[model samples]
Structures are given as C-alpha cells and as structure tokens.
Target: MASSSTNLNAQSKFDVFLSFRGEDTRTGFTSHVVEALRRKQIQFFIDDEELQRGEEISPALLNAIETSDISIIIFSKNYASSTWCLDELVRILDCKKRNGQIVVPVFYKVDPSDVRKQMGSFGEAFVHHERNFPGEVRVQKWRDSLIQASNISGFHDSRSFRNDAELVEKIAEDISKKLEDLADPPNFDGYVGFNSQIERIKSLLCLELDDVRIVGIWGMGGIGKTAIAEAVFHQISSREYSNHFDGKCFMRNVREESRKMGALYVRDEAISRVLGESNLKIGTLTINSYIWKRLRRSKVLIVLDDVDDNFIQELESLVGQLNLYGPGSRIIITTRNRGVLGVNSIVYKVKGLEHDKACELFCRKALSRKNRSDDLLELSKKVACYADGNPLALEVLGSSLRQKSKEQWYNKLHDLTLISEPRIYKVLKISYDELSPKHRKIFLDIACFFKGEQVDNVTRIQDKPTSLRYELEFLADKSLITISYKRLQMHDLLQEMGQTIVREESEEPGKRSRLWDHEDVYDVLTKNKVRINLFDIIFLSIHP
Candidate 1:
C-alpha cells in the first residue's frame, strides 16, 4: 500500500479544500494558508474559475468539496454578495452533512451572528439579490447553508491572533494535527516475523480462482492473526492478478471496535468502505436487502479483522449469503474462535514464529537495531526462548527490556519463570475475559489441574456437571484449550497466566479460586478451611 493509503477516508482525495471569496483573501490570508499547507505537504484544492452572472457551481468544484477531508470557509463582508460563492458554500455544507467532511469557518472581519442571521452586510447582499431576481428558487437554501456553517465551532478572527500570519499558522497547524489523527492504519514498518505466515495465507487464498471464497485465519490472541490478514489484504489490493476486484476494504479490529462503537457503526463502516459510498445510513432502507442487491453487481475483497464468535451472525447479515456476492469476491475473517466460522469454512491455524526468527525479532526490538551486542546476544536468545515464539510476548518483553543492564535482563528472565509479565498477560487475558463464567471456570480448571488429563476421565468426575463436555468444547473453540489424542492441552504461557491470576485473587490458597500445588491443596483440605463468598464450595481436581 502507498504511504498515503493509511489516510484513506470515504472519499478523501484532498486533505484540505479552500472555499472562500477569492477577492477577499486569495492574495493574503488564503495564500498564506496554502503556502503553509504546501510546506507541510498537505494536499489541497482551490477553484480559480471566474464566475459569470447566474452561472452554476462547476461540477469540478463540487466534486473537490465532496472529496476533501476538510473545508475552510472564509466568511467575509462581501462573501454572500456572489452567487458563485454562495453556491460553493451550499455544496460545502451539503458535503459536511453527507460525507462527514470537516468544516472550518474563518470569521474574517464579519460577525458570526450577522452571518447566521444574514444581517448588516449580509442583509445588504440579500436585499440586492432579492431586487435583482425576485422569488429566486435557491435563495432560502443559501440562507440555510450559511446558518448551518456558522453554527459549527471554528476559528473566529478577532483579537485572538497577533496578526493574519499568526492566524494562518494556527489554522494550518491545527488542521495538520487533525489529519494526523484521522484513520492512520496499524504501523507495520518495524513489524517482523510474519512474512512466511502471510505467504502461506496468500497461497491458500488462490487469487487465480474465480470462486467467492471465505477463508478463516484462526489462532489464539496475539498470535499475529490480524497482522497476517492485513498483509494479505494489502497484497490483494496491490497485486497484479488479485487486483481485479471492483472494491477493496480492510475492516480492522472488528471485535474491539464493535465493542467500543456499536455494531451498527462497524456494519456501516464495512458498507461505506466496500461500497465506496460516503456516510451511508442504512436505517433509511432495508439495509440487508439493499446490500444483497448492491453486492451482487461488483466483486469486492474484504477483510473482517479480529472477529469474535459472537460477531459471526452479524457477519452473515453484513455479507448477505456468500453465494450472492459477485464472482471473485473473497472474504477473510481473523478469529480466535474457529467455531465462529463453522465446521465447513476453510481455516488456517496460525502458530508461533520459529526459534531463529523469534530470536531475530526479539533482538531487533530489544536493541532497537538490526545488529546485536556480543554481551547481549546470549541474553537476547534466552529472553526470546522464554517468549516461546509468540510474537506479541516477544514485542512486549523485548521493548520493555530495551537498553536495560545485563543483570536486569537476567532478572527479567528469572521473573518470567515465576509469572506472566503484566503487559503480555493483559493482552492474552482479553480472550479469557471474554469467555462466559462457566467456560472460564472450565478453562481455569484445565490450566490448574486437568491439563493433559484424558477427556473422558475429566468428564467422568463425580461432582462434575453433564455440561463439562460442552464447556470443554467451548474452550477448545476459543483456543484456550486443545483436544489431542483424547487428552486436554494448553499453551505454557496461558497456563501460567491462569495460575498467576488465581494467585493474585488471594494470598491464602483456601480463599483462591483454584489450588494447583500439592502442599496448598493438602493444607486447605486438611485444615477444614471455610471457603470465601466468591466460591461457595472450593473446587479441586479429584485425579488420582
């Protein structure tokens, strides 16, 4: 993807659109703002066409307004006098409402109240227009546009600035900061250790195939599932053979964003990106039916990143029956829970990086350079080994250990033996935190006591509920537990993380949720300790 691709919005062709009375500020304040924008490499457009009497706003000008991310309207005394400027104002306001375009109004020696009410100089202009063209069809629309634009919060040119240059600098700097915050995609410049995984997924994608395929990248949290999907998405966007799709959209952080901003927001986000429409509100129409009709005509490649099991039903409505999608359309979903995709969907399970690649990645992050110090080389390898090839763990630990003394590195590695690092634990905990209470108990039980136990034996425990198998399968679906050869298994880090969580619940074993160590279990049971309110009865494994 291009460097500017990160700044993509609904129809963002220009960063700034300058709409003003050319006669008022073109040579002075407007030119300075444009110069400042040019210095900062801010893309912008300004119309220079001379307006003839009763002429309409140029299509080129309207398109520029719609495409621009931000519009700066300079409200001057004579700004309302020209029908041309009024027409541009009306279009800019329309874009603001329709495309979510940002609008900045510069009250250049004109009162905002006057602009809103069309008073004083504004009144004079309207009076002249009324006398010239009685009962003008668009006169009320121009007044409404002025009112709407004036109501928005923007810079007021008054005693607030030292001079016009200061004002121009302030406005330009403010807009630069805004553009920086608008939709910068995840940075992968220093991203490492996932090239092969990306390649494997791409081969599975089989871009040459003409069928509409759904591919699921399934893995535990922080295993680089989203990273791999993002790489494939960008490749399909730019690659020669795969670039035949009519539209492309990468809907990132689907799980997190849907939780943060309602599911409707995510649904609409996917629609506008894949459909290439601006600020499309699905409420006005039968949206699923509308999508069903619109998607059948054009092939589109879309990635729903970091999806959860709960979001799959919404995904069905969003894409609307996979076969109905236009030919060659490919949909990729990244998830921690494979069951969310069902038994039939093609799933690629993502594993950790190999040891050598893991070491290389850790060294790069820890040293902040490609080269490594001879003294730290062995220590780096040791730290990487502790990370167990998990990319997120390596990144968090490596960056945290950057520039630390050799003794500190040893202490850090020693700390890893006893507990999961808090930062790494926080990320891996999200999957656990999202689980149902019953499933969470099942997960902790496996982590603490039942890991590697035969599935039938664990399920046959006298006190265990009949739903144990259901909960086990649920945990397996979430990748928190594994079923292999009739035995349950779990990742070393996740197991340790669960134990750490239990320990933190209370210092006393009797009060904690689960007891793993033999001495702790014996002490609690033999002492006849009363269980805490949180757990009515202390649960422990009855394995021989």
Candidate 2:
C-alpha cells in the first residue's frame, strides 16, 4: 500500500484536498478517510476550525484547493448546511474548470440522485439557506455547483460501494492509480535505441552535484533530440526527483511557445509552472526579478526543448537577466546547433539509431508489427538502410509502405533508390509537396532564415497576408517542419531540399530567388551580373 502511493508520482502540493461537513463526518467517515490517506503518506489538506472559522473561505484554504491535484468532496447529510463547506465546493469546482483539477464526490450515506436534484436532506439544507440568507445569489451558486459536481463520475455509497472501510480503501487506491497515471513518464511506446542515449545524458547531468547543471542535447533535426530529452526528463522526474523535489518539474517546448507567444511569455510560463503559480504575469522589468526571487533557492528539473541558434541569444539574455534557479537545479536544453550551448555546458550529440534498432522501427511502422515478417524482412532492411538510421525517415517510409503488397514494396524501394539526392530528402519532399502554397512558403522561410528563430521574430520577417501559425502547425503535422521550444525546426535534409529547390529555380546563381552562397553573392555583386533576380541574399565575410 505504501509502495502503491509512492508509485503514483503525482506532482502536486497536496495529493488530495478533503472537502466535507466537519460536524457530520469529521469524526466518522471523513476521519477514517483521513487516517487512510495518512497511512499511505499522501499529502492532504482537510480544513479545520482554525482555517474555516471565517465567513468566507480563507485565502490559505483557497490556495490549497487550487494547488491540490485532486479534490475529494464528501457529500454527507448536513454538508450543504455549512456555508463554509458550500464556499469551498464552489472554489473546488472553479479549480476543476480552470486548472484541470480532478474532483471526486463521495456520497457518504447521501443519495447521488438526491445530491444532484437537491432533494431530501440536501433540499432541506438549501431551504434553510433560502430562509436565512433570503434569496442571496450565493445560495443559488452553491446549488448549481453541487448539481455540476454530482454529475461527475465518483464514488457512490448506495449503488457503487457499501462498506465504509472498503470504500475508504477503494478511494485511496483509485487516487493512487490516478497519481500513478499522472506520474507515469511519457510513453516511448515503440521507441528504440534511446535507453543508451538517456543513460549517457544522465551521466553528463551529474545529479549528485549541488550546483546548477545545464546540459545540452545537440543534433541535426529529426535525430530524436526532443524524444531523448523527454525520456530522460520524465525518467528523472518520476523516479529520482519525485521524492526530493515534490513534483517541481517544468518541461516546455520553448521554440513552440516562444514563436507562438513570445520569448517573454515562455519565460513567464516556465517560472509560473515551476513555482506552481498559474496565470503569473510579469513585465520586462519584473520578469527577471520574479524568476530569480521564486527559483533562486528551489531545486527543480527544467527541460527547454527545440532551442535554435536565433533564439539562443534571447535565451542567454533571459538566463543572465533572470539569474535563474537555485543550486541543485538541472536545465536540459535540446538544440540542433551546437553553438547554441554555452562553452561550459555539457553537450551530448544525439546520433541516429543503430542499424538493428532502425530495422525494428521500420518493420514496426511498415508492417504494423515489431516481429520481422519473412516476406518483408529483406525489403524492410533495404528501406532501413536508405533511412540511414534516421527514425523520422524510417517512420515515414515505413508508414508509406504499410499494408502494401510485396510487389508494390519492391517497386517503391526501386523508385526510392533511383532518387539522385539523399533518400531522406526525397522521402521528406512528399510531405513538403503536400503543403499549401502558404505553408510551403512558411516551410521554406524556416529552412532559410527562421529555423530555430523565435515565432515572434519569424512573424516579423514574413510579409504574408495571413497568420503563419496555422501553416506552421500544418507543416508540423505533415512532419515537413517541427515547432519546438516555439521555434521552427527543419531536418538537415529538408533544409538542403529547400535550398536545392531555390537553386533549381534558375540555372544561373544570379537568377535565383534566394542566394546563401558567399561566392555567388560576390559574383552577383562584384561582377555586376545582369540577371540578379534574387529576393534574398546572404553574404558572409570571414576575417583570418
């Protein structure tokens, strides 16, 4: 039972917030529930007279309700009589609506239908309130709150449960299961060749150190940096850190959020999430102060995913300005560019999956089963080889060939080999060509100027008529481009393809729409080329 509770990995200030009528069930049913929660070592908050004596729910009690991951509302005979209990109910319901708090109504000797319809004792309590409070809006609100809460599926005394002790154990078990589910790390279902990388990164993290550690996971796009980081983060979060940190873990797609909102918004959200402070608003002046003040002494695990070169400066500035985090804090950053990581930061370069792992992944994707099919094994190996251990390519190719006949598979494999460019590029082009013109433009822009650039910065660069957010999401869904850490990310192969497309627009370099080659730009400029049809040109000058 103790092991069961520990296994839940539920990240919340309180495991459960017990809402009940003290006079009715405090020493009886509620007391038994409290003892069960205590034996399990679950963190819970049950308001006592000291906290509930005021006319209104105390700020402390309200905070507790908001922070708790789950609320167990005991619907007893006299539950509605206490205005304080009714107020707490309203707050719990509000938290459920706004914060995704889980509410469980335990009908202890009260009928579920009576509670929902406000009949019998529930009706009597409301009637008394109507007479004493005299048609106040507060009474009506409580009634509505009760009706809504009762509709939610929870423990019912008469129908679903009978014995009180048995019910208490069931509730504890159910809560434990919910916590376990919440604490369960991101499913790497069908994930392959990631355990070794996770171990390597974990060793680099050096969790034993008391100092803040910022480790960088760097690789080309589609190399599984994000996946690897996610696995490691969740493993650390659910296993080792749960006991020490009490659920203080924050993982954000920094590129995605930074692009969709802004860098500041991402910064604000990170602080808010780690500190368990929701809807936390901070300006440029106060954001840094707030972050440092809140996080300076707190040990936390933070993962900033999909960082890029363009956003690196902003991140650096933010880190410096905020002076983020206390000692023992660990920040994991996943980026395509190695330059994005600071000099002192430990960097782990994510590599492609091994041949065997790649083959297994391919077979799983293409055959819809992990076990190698005798008929498709040879073709699967060929496809895996073409994928070059790239998980994304394997997935795309495998999915493309799924449920196809052997003859069709052979024809597709032959066609795949005939492509002059890299196999991965050819495979990615399918997704690229599927995009609308607007989405295509967005993908091309990201491949060129906006890759790893913040969303706000990318929006500033585009002269488009419509919002690129939708187009960006479309590209991401198609796997042509990815939005991580709020920045646009493209695989090296896709980037190459985009560049190749621009180059193929015209035979002469000067006639191309975009020119990144320094020699071509120099020839276009210094030689005064006649057909300079370029819309964008990047010139790089190196000093030796």
Task: List runs of model 2 lying over 4 Å from the truth.
Answer: 1-78, 81-185, 239-243, 246-252, 285-290, 318-324, 370-372, 420-423, 430-544
Query: How does candidate 1 fare on TM-score?
Result: 0.49
| TM-score (C-alpha) between model 2 and the true structure | 0.55
Best by lDDT: 1
Shift in Å, residue 86, candidate 2: 11
Please list the C-alpha lDDT of all candidates, in the order they appear.
Answer: 0.74, 0.72
How many Å off is the CA of 306 in candidate 2?
Answer: 1.0
lDDT of 1 by residue, 1-544 (tens): 1112223244446788887887888887777877767655567876654434347765656667788888888888889998888888888888888888889898988899999999999999999888877898789898899899889988864457888888887887778667756645556632477888788888887778777788899987767887788878866765345357766788766775575556677877777666655455674223667676788887988899878765666776665466777888888888888777854457899988898888887777678564467868888887777667777667656665667777878777776655555356754565476567877777788877777667877888647657788777766645566686578877555777888888999988898877666577678868979543332233333331
Tell me the TM-score of each prediction against the true structure. Answer: 0.49, 0.55
Q: Which ten residues in a row have the lowest lDDT in candidate 1?
A: 1-10
Local error of candidate 2 at 111, Å? 19
RMSD of 2: 13.0
RMSD of each: 18.3, 13.0
Clashing pairs in 1: none
- Give, for candidate 2, the lowest lDDT window spanning 10 residues: 1-10
